[model samples]
Target: MTGPTELPVPDTVDVRSGPEVSDQLLSLLPLLGEWHGEGVMTGTAAGSAQDVRFGQWMRFSHDGRGFLAYESRTWRLTDEGRIVGPDVRETGFWRPRGDDDVELLTASPEGLVEIYVGRARTTTSWELTSDVVARTPDAADVTRAVRLYGLVEGALMYAIDRAGADDPLRPTMSARLERLR
Candidate 1:
């Protein structure tokens, strides 16, 4: 896995106000708060059930350029709340394109560089597709993932798709998460 790198500074002149960021980006802001949900990760090798809690916070600033600077920290709960996974920190930039689109660039140790194209679907919902690529030597063995984000009833819902194996067929795992404030 890779670690964070110092991002190249941008060249610019504006600090405040163009068109307020896209609704798609705004819709994701609420997710900045704490979120607790149960996640089940199952694979061909083994499976386990455990309580999962994730916390996140995001801040947007200006780097003198037209881009909105963004950074966030995520924490995973473990050991009856006594332990936590390595704090997953994500730093990136967001920029609103035309009237309905926004672009997000991010990197993580998972050896992934992601470019997310977000489109507003409605007043309370939006959709985003991430183009992800692995940067490691064993990248060929990794599969691509497509994620869908939407609100069901009043809860946040997510779905993922991965390249399926050619061998014996089996159902893929999918999950739904409700906001627990």
Candidate 2:
């Protein structure tokens, strides 16, 4: 999207603090930082119950633009208690359509792409529902997803629900992350 005609758009904007952000995005300021945490994932893989403990690192930042840049990496814990993998990595952008409406476009190396429509419930909370779910021919059979994010006790907390091919929607993951910066 182009900048408002009245304000001249710069050729480049410093991601940190170089330019002013539109007011529409201000409601999401609480998410503009790095966060790290641990969580447990429970589900069935191919009809077998699978549970895993994972560590996550997520960052949401801006380039003085209207949208926030996003990136997340997760590692699985081994039974013996060792951290391994970046089993999953996702990159995306969160664009505020208005004070109470937002959009998220995300892509994962695992061959999944998603667009989520979110509604702000409060200045620091949002409920997101997938508008589209596209996957590469070889990607996992994820068919639908929903997410919730909020600031609870000064920490970022989130939960995700997912449904795959022939699978019912179920809670997939949830985590509480401390802001690192």
Candidate 3:
């Protein structure tokens, strides 16, 4: 992708009394809704081969703004497909830098904060590489990460890979979520 360019300002911009979406956010409009689905998480956790089925609920909404607000909650599932308990939660914002470039700012309850920068491969897809990864003193030693998101068959699909001080980049998690709104 090309370097960032100055985005054009609208002739007039003002707050609306009711919900409204901005043209700058139209590229990501497909994700402006709630999504729910289930998948599996497989990797090394707690020094063991961590493998588990899970369910997730994700939401992307805007308040007459230029960026989309994002939040996700996941739950562990029993072998019989029952939700056993809460697993992980994340909060973030998907900010479009221009027509192509975008930035993702996210934090995990697990004490990790990540910033990813990349371009929108398409109106419905993005491939991002971590520009900065920060961790709390008590967090895991994550050093690198990559993420991909796209709309496949009308479903939101995403995958993530990560590496730590002692490991190479490897698959962390992936899932397909169906829009609920």
lDDT by residue for model 3 over 15-99, one digit each (tens)? 3333567788867777778899987777464233667778999988777778888899999887799989998799999898888
lDDT of 2 by residue, 45-162 (tens): 2132777778889998765768888999888877676997766689999888866898988999989999999888898899999999999998878999999999999999998888
TM-scores of all predicted structures: 0.51, 0.85, 0.86
Q: Tell me which of candidates 1 and 2 scores higher on TM-score.
A: 2
lDDT per residue as tens, model 1, 1-181:
9755855553222223333433444434433222334332334311335434444443455544445565545555454654466444557776656665767676656454667777656644556565554456633233444545456776555544444335432322334455443
The residue ranges of model 2 lying beyond 4 angstroms of the native Cα positions read: 1-16, 45-48, 79-81
Candidate 3 worst ten-residue window by lDDT: 9-18
Better of 1 and 3 by lDDT: 3
Error of 1 at 38 (Å): 9.4
Better-scoring candidate (TM-score), 2 or 3: 3
Arrange candidates, best lDDT first.
Answer: 3, 2, 1
The best-first sequence of candidates by TM-score reads: 3, 2, 1
lDDT of 2: 0.82
List where candidate 1 sits over 4 angstroms from the true fold. 1-52, 62-66, 138-143, 148-181
